[model samples]
Target: MTPAQHNTPAFHDLFATHPRLTGLALAPDGTRLIASGQTSDADGTGYVPGLWEVDRAGDDGIRPVTGSGPGDFAPAFAADGTLMFLSGRDPGERGGTGDVALWALPERGAARRIAHHPSGIATFAVAAGADTVAYTAALLPGATDAESHGRLRRARKDAKVDAVLYEAGPVRAGGDGEPHTFVRHADGAPMDIGGQGLAGNGDTALSPDGSLAAYTRAPTDQAPDTNCVVVADAVTGAERHVFSRAGNQYYHPVFTADGSALVCQRQREETHDTEWRVTLVAFDLASGAETDLLPGFDNWPWPGRPLPSPLPGDGTLWFTGDEQGHCPVFRRDADGTITRLTALGAYGSLCVTPDATTLYALRGAVDGPPRVVRLDVAAPDQEPVFLTAAGGLEPLPGTLTEVRTEAEDGCPLRAWLALPEGASAERPAPLVVVPHGGPQGSWSDWPWLWNPWPFTARGYAVLLPDPALSSGYGQRMQRRGLGGFGEVPYRDVMALTDAALGRADLDAARTAMAGWSFGGYLAARTATLTDRFRAIVSHGGMWNLEAFQMDTDMSAYFRKLFGDPRTQRERYEADSPHLDAAKVTTPVLIVHGGEDHRVPTGQALGFHNDLRRLGVPVRFLYFPDEGHDIGVPNHIRVLYETMLNFLDHHVLGQEWRRPPLL
Candidate 1:
């Protein structure tokens, strides 16, 4: 290819058009590797997904296995090596069902819908030996059969009713009617493994024999906000609570090879004095006893997915954990020894060969997009073999470096600094300080949204800092921010930002700050505390602590950390960003989604009004159809384009270039 043709597309354009890989599923026989691939539609307004066969040997490349049109995702494999996935594609000319159903693709024939539900299948998994499918659906209350549930749904739709009546339960975000679990044989009717509901973020696994299914069940008793692990007889539809605790959250249940026990993660509830402490645990199914698998490990196993050892009846598990700056795979032996597996980049979507010899995962780095990689699990110290080329990521326009600093409280703070190419003492790049969201999440892996490449490609040095509350830094680092939002997290972010700007390759005078979600709160908080930044961008941020505690989706969880807003009046007022709006002198850009349940859009509206009333330069970009995240392809382009324009006008003293499409 020519030089210009070989160049990577600009960040905004690439995000809109790039063919992306998501979710990996390995066949039981380890003969096929399937993954969901999404490409931009004709209008460039959304992504259309289809399953692709990924060559495991790295000799042949990836090829599409499904036809185009509507999106298909969440790929899985039945015991017989049939590829199954969830899709919204309708089988008949009845138009569309408006809900996803389970579809199976055979080796010699076309794909066909196998199982479906009235409320649609939320997710599904198949047994490793019998092809027994376990799926979750949202069923109406008191509806005994699918016919009655379908009638109730139709009636509600005809009446234009959109109200959910929760007699006694804590409301959850993005929840529909009520989640119910069901299991089915390869060619038999689905049997109800009835429960109150599946935990919103819980996962399910089926035994190799397909006799039992394990999943996290939502609290149905007096304990309003608790979750428990339950194992159900797939054939008889009977369930028993294998593990439950009053003050702990249990999730991601995986059955052992022999089905004698389950490996899961337990997280103690967060409180005012402590952050979340998570531990990998094993529960004896027959005895109902729990054991701490990682007793003394300091780092948290984020997304701590437990996988059964490939060997028959091995009783060992493999999981992933975040430590320092990289996420690595770790194996727990039957003798309680923990061995670190792969060590280079952040890894996810882990799958192992049938022989327990090879491991495959999507490895990602700050400077590159995620791609399939293979590792020799038998040899733990070897580097990974790249199976799939990094799609759409040509050479980055900059180099990614690390920034280390010490917080005032003696805590170590770190950040990823991306300096534009050719940046030097004579032509230092303008700086952009971007803190990650979740406050609880780290910037150890490559990020699709809130990425820094767009800024780095524009001759700006971006600083992605893992502040006090950021994960991968051990429990003590998270505990340092327990005092309040404006305390250690803010101090750590500013410390790292200052350290990055102190370097001769960065221009401190032309610096801006931006973040989304909790990071957005920190960015707005920084605006109130300092005028060092020329511009600030806050997206989906909380402005008033009192209002946030009252209106957020997880209000109970919020109250647990900050106490009741009504009783603890001082704490609410002390850290609220809106209370200090008059102190902001920098130009501010506010972005929010109307349907954001986590941090309500009112936070943005109120903060914008307060800043505007204080005579501060502010602009608001609102997406009424969007939720906590702006998922639309065109909207993503506009989001980044507007952000770059705002930074250019404010920080670089250039004319604002409004996106013509917007």
Candidate 2:
């Protein structure tokens, strides 16, 4: 491909029109693979997802299962070779007032609506063995039936109060929405969980026999949310808690092949100072017995995903985890012998053929977008083969290079450096270092959000460093930045940045840094410590440590980090950027979603006010309609455009151009 072919499009043309590939599932026969990808009208106004059926070898090419405009997603294959998915078709035709409805497509003919509800399905599960289907729908606090729930919703809209009664912690942002009632279709019509709806994140997992269903529920309003595994009869909806411990959080429950026990990931806290360690466990229903699976395994299941793609009768369950810098897939035997199946890159949306031998997943790396790749878990030595080129993105504007360095504590750190194609020794590129969030997160995999292509397209080299808190690196590496959040991680990022700058093609003088969430907090902290960068853009950043610990929906969780704001003044003062804002000389760009409950809009407001009060050059890009992550397509476009403009002006010394909406 020509270098020019890699040219990134204009902000408007790029953000709204860029493709998205997700929801990968394998047909029972393993003859075809199903996936959902983005499709937009000529005007880009009609953005939607269309399903594709891909051949195993992709020799015959991909075939479209849906036409256009309708937002189709979450492709789940049933035992009978039926490809079931959710779509936002017309309500009159789908028999629902809400936009989205669950529809099923048989192997031979057209698709049919399997379920529809007014509140729309937040999440759903299709039983692997039986025909039972379970879905979760949003319900009011005290309502029982669909009609009363619908009426309560309408009344709230009519009253225009926009007020929520919060007698609990974690009301918004990162927290799950009010207890979604599980609507299951087993005996006859769909039914809710019980008299009191289960307070959980709708992580529904059904047993192979289709008799029992397991889901994760947050048991209380404590500072740190603890998930309790709930197992219930799929048909009767009679549920009870299983294998829960007072000091540990349990989630990601799935039934064993025999359906006699449930296997789940457990996060137990041995001490307050150390990081949480994730382990796999097998819980027997009859004896209320729990046995640890893969005893030494430290990788987090993340999002409560129980097991990787399980072959129908396969005794072992497979999964994905990060080791070193790459996210690889691994499988565990009945004896808890865990074997690594993949060597490099990151994998997601794992699906195994019913025969259980072949595994298919969406694989991506630092330089590439998401792709459908095939692997043989049984043949763990074999490398994964890219199955369908359907998810291949337009050629990137830059090339990727992996940089490695060591922290002061001797922990190995790495980062992905994306440089513009034309960048060279003579034509050095400005640097845009993007520290990742999750403090517990990593840049080891592919993600469309905070993608570095936009910056590289603008003649900038982007640095995505995997620091102390990043995953896939061992539990010991994770423990490095536990409560401090500043020492080792900061050093690792700078160490890699220093290593990257040693290259002739990168310029340290025209440098800037940007990140969101934890990365945003790091960016704010980085600015206070050093004037190494010309500009710093912090999105949903935590500048004021004390206020953030108190105001967020996860105040309880943050308290685990900062402790009591009044008592832990030393940690807060040393770590919080707001405490030392006067030391920041770099131009600041604060971007925040007003509805952000995780970081909260207050963090951005207070930081911006401080920047302005101290006479520091600052600009605020606040989206009132957005949350922690910008959901609106238009707002996303504006987000990237605004960040691009900010960097272009401050780092490249280019003529500042205002974004359209601004």
Candidate 3:
């Protein structure tokens, strides 16, 4: 299809309408596969869980394993034909307050609810022997007298009783609860006991005999130090610190079949940011010595992108990395020999069958929805078998052009610029500076299945940059602007705007900044720092770090990152843009989800109040039913449409059209 056809209202409407596909898995024997995703209807109504199964034997015959409903996900299999997963509903088929329950289905038909809870199940995995299942569950927040923060529980395959094997959190020792907690199981319950540090930011692996478990533990909170890996006795829960480096975050721990060695992905911290040097390191469990597996290979750094799943017999390790321009699958054998597995464009969320012969991947391009595919590792170049075709959304065609410019400090910055179909580079077009959330996270060229397109389709030039704090580059580059949120990143953005102004196709004077979470904070600060932009939008952002630290869900995490406000009160006061509210002259829009625990609504309301007090042009929109990310379609449409009107009034100098107040 032509580029214009791809950007049609029907195409954009399809994406706006469809529920996103997420989380894919393969059955133990490698014969069957399961996928957990979401589906939404045309009016943005039908939001439901999706469970699908596929036969790897021929063309990856894919079919829906469960009928469409409100909640279903975290799919795993007990054996070849017995599928087990989590559904976000009770046995009565009623939607509940907490997570969904455990459900089972035979390979041939409909699913039946096996377990339900008032709190909810976070995740689950069946043991290698297929006799038991181990899962993680957390008590719902705001529940009175909740005993557990999060715990590891286990149940037999044929038994109805579930028992808690280990529990952690609800830590009241340091005058507050722990930063974060999660249970990682190497195999299944009883024998599968493993624990990581606060962040729930680690990986776990079990030995072939299931006798040992290896895991990585990194400080999940804002603490700049404390990253390590521990090997533990599977039955006893005794942990031995096998590997650790100060300031380096080790993740994705995997064990060799024999359990003699453990392999993990390591990224060192230069300052506050994690550099993207994800190399495989082999830790000899006996000697505790580590060896680099692929020392020079660069892996793409993106959240929710699954790392390479190690195979049992073949000394090869498989992973996804940016090859040329797209993220393709590659395999590196024991001798350090690397081979490309799939020739298809950017792919992610890879899962290998228990037998390790077949690989399942989500494959797609910059303009379309991703489809699940099965690839034969033995035959690298053969056409992949399409397991399921993604419905609803059509691809939006446009060329992804790379733009690089130097920050004010002379540091090089990178961005992706996507222009409208027939838009000429010679004419000036409105621009949007879309900063990604994790200030630490970098924007990749892969299509954002949920964002930026809605604005781009309206003929706006979208500029996404990997600023100083963004990961992927080395540690030094990642930490260049440490503790300089208002200083360095702002300079980089200004420099980017300067470069954009030089481009005849970009209307630099008519630009706006938009972002979520940390990105939102930066956008709000940008409006106060300078009046260069016509408008700004903040989603789930904090105006004051000190206030946010005290009010946020993970206060300890915030303290670690920004430090105790009592001791560093000056830093908090100086860094906060809310302190400089009088300087904000540009029109601003703030959108927040009332249910967001990360950044509470108080932050948005406080800023909105301050903006009004300062006589600044500002608007506040709240989504009461949603959390950090607003998932409801009507809310999303309202948000985008309101944002567009705000941009139109300022950037296009159109008359102000007020949207319905939330």
Candidate 4:
């Protein structure tokens, strides 16, 4: 008997059939590890997520734990070793209520729904050492119990009322009815830990003893809606503000081992001259004093739910942070000394064993998909031991190399250049410049959606440039691109691109550029500024800066970055890509998700309209059901197909044949 072999060069099938690994958790006993895996349905139009169990000792292969899936995700283990997760499976299919509910899977029996709510559970957290769970769900203003909330939900549904009424400006959407946090013991009725209204997209945490619960909420009194963290008594529902500043955001609270302090991330407000910075801070529960945990550490720390040290009540913490092109684990001891752990590949879903001797994380690089890896906590410099296989990936069809250049102001710019196989001086591969989103994010790890393999496999060279606003390069790089999107970031991108093109294996004359979100904005902006690229593609990109400043999901954050668009017209006029639509001569393919509120679909529509009226060769690919990022499996196919087709015609000098599915 033998296993089956899979074929390669299946670009469409790659996305259609590949199983994606996300979100990881370790059982209390530390013998089992669980990860959420999603695979495309038969038709590849949607994805069904399930839970998979991985052997901690790497002896047995990975196995599935949940078969009847209605999208099980956010795997976590209760202290009693019960596997807990959230699911939306239909009642008939899996005894689920068809609403997102908290389910528990005991080690000896089948999984069962433990907590049901009229409104689905948005997010949840379990105490590290107690049978306590805290979760958030939506309930109408006057509704108390599940019955009352169900009535209210029915009333709204009967009236077909899906609109969100905003009594103020900077309106946003999504995240269910109205959110509130609750806590519960094993098989006990949940208690509402009363506090200010929870933010639609904020996180919640439970103290190790389950005595305190922390959550975040947006300020109702102000326009720039930044979150403020609040601590509530799990039993009394009495709430107290932990951290709240007018222009800052405090979120993702994690309780210290002794439960006397809370460590959380703070997103500092940005001005026209400075970009936002995210760092960790600890709040002393006794005095309500805020202490900057890593004041001298400039890198952005990817804080996981902190794991206790080998000693029970030690205040030592473990987390990951980005440096250069890799994300490494870092340890902050109880004495405030910081030490860097492993020094390769990016990491996520980090967890530690109960004994605190070994640490586990999903490690991936630009050249490889993520795999489960374990490291000895005491040996910080030792290489990680692999526990699960890396996504069954073959050798990359291309070669990955680093490119470096100096920006106009002498700041160092770096990028990852992936050259297709057989690219050489005599036959240089055509180039496609891809700038990452976030402007605050880095292109350090393997990205499933915006992956470069498909393009490289098709004989195209992909350039991933980390420009001025990219992370891992420290504050100076971020501060250089603060005032507007058009100036330093754009120059940094061009600088890196030029350095890549100078190589003998990349064709400079035959090139194109594409991006998403902030990168999308850069692509659109670059199309207007340069005619070097034969084609341009912008997905979920922003065009009109003024309109974008007012309509995005985090409009207040942008408002604080750049002042009122009405009053501060200089920044809008200088940076808005829509303002120079008439200058775009390159053929353009505009892709946008109709439901995208982050960059918004309007940016695409307006850009397309202007280009069409000006007789610029333009095509618009719109997905009405998608959001800021395209998640639908089939839509993902159409996106790549259309993009490749457009590039083939404009950059590769091939005939334009639109994808049949589109």
TM-score of each: 0.95, 0.92, 0.79, 0.95
Provide the clashing-pair count of each candidate structure: 0, 3, 5, 0
Error of 3 at 462 (Å): 1.3
TM-score for model 1?
Answer: 0.95
Query: Scored by CA lDDT, what does every candidate get?
Result: 0.80, 0.74, 0.64, 0.80
Residue 550 displacement (Å), model 1: 1.2
> For residues 1-662, what per-residue lDDT tens digits would candidate 3 score against the true structure?
11132344533455556656676777666766666777764467446777766665546456676543456677766644577778776565545434467777776676676654434554554444424444433333322212333221221223643433233331221211222222233233233244343344425554544455566554544443556777766556577556876656677666665557777776653332333345567788778888887776554433333334444445667776654334567777778877777664667778776667778887765455677787876566467777776565434444567677887667777766766555555555688887767666666434432266676666677777667676655455556767666667777776766776677767666788988887898898898788888889898888977788778866655665666778877667767888888899988999998888888889999899999998888888778878888776666667777787788787888797876643
- Model 2 lDDT tens row, 605-650: 8899998999999999988877887655666678788888898788
Q: Using alpha carbons, what is the TM-score of model 2?
A: 0.92
Error at 506, model 3, angstroms: 2.7
Model 2 clash pairs are: 223-556, 322-472, 438-441
Q: Which parts of model 4 have CA positions greater than 4 angstroms off? A: 1-8, 66-70, 90-92, 95-97, 168-170, 195-198, 221-225, 303-310
**Candidate 1 clashing pairs, residues 3+ apart or interchain:** none
State the displacement of the C-alpha of residue 175, model 2, in Å, after optimal TM-score superposition.
13
Question: How close is each model in CA RMSD to the real structure?
Answer: 2.9, 3.2, 6.5, 3.5
Q: How far out, in Å, is residue 260 in model 3?
A: 3.8
Query: Residue 613: error of model 1 in Å?
Result: 1.2
In the range 381-414, model 1's lDDT, one tens digit per residue, is 4578888877765677778999998999888888
Q: lDDT of candidate 4?
A: 0.80
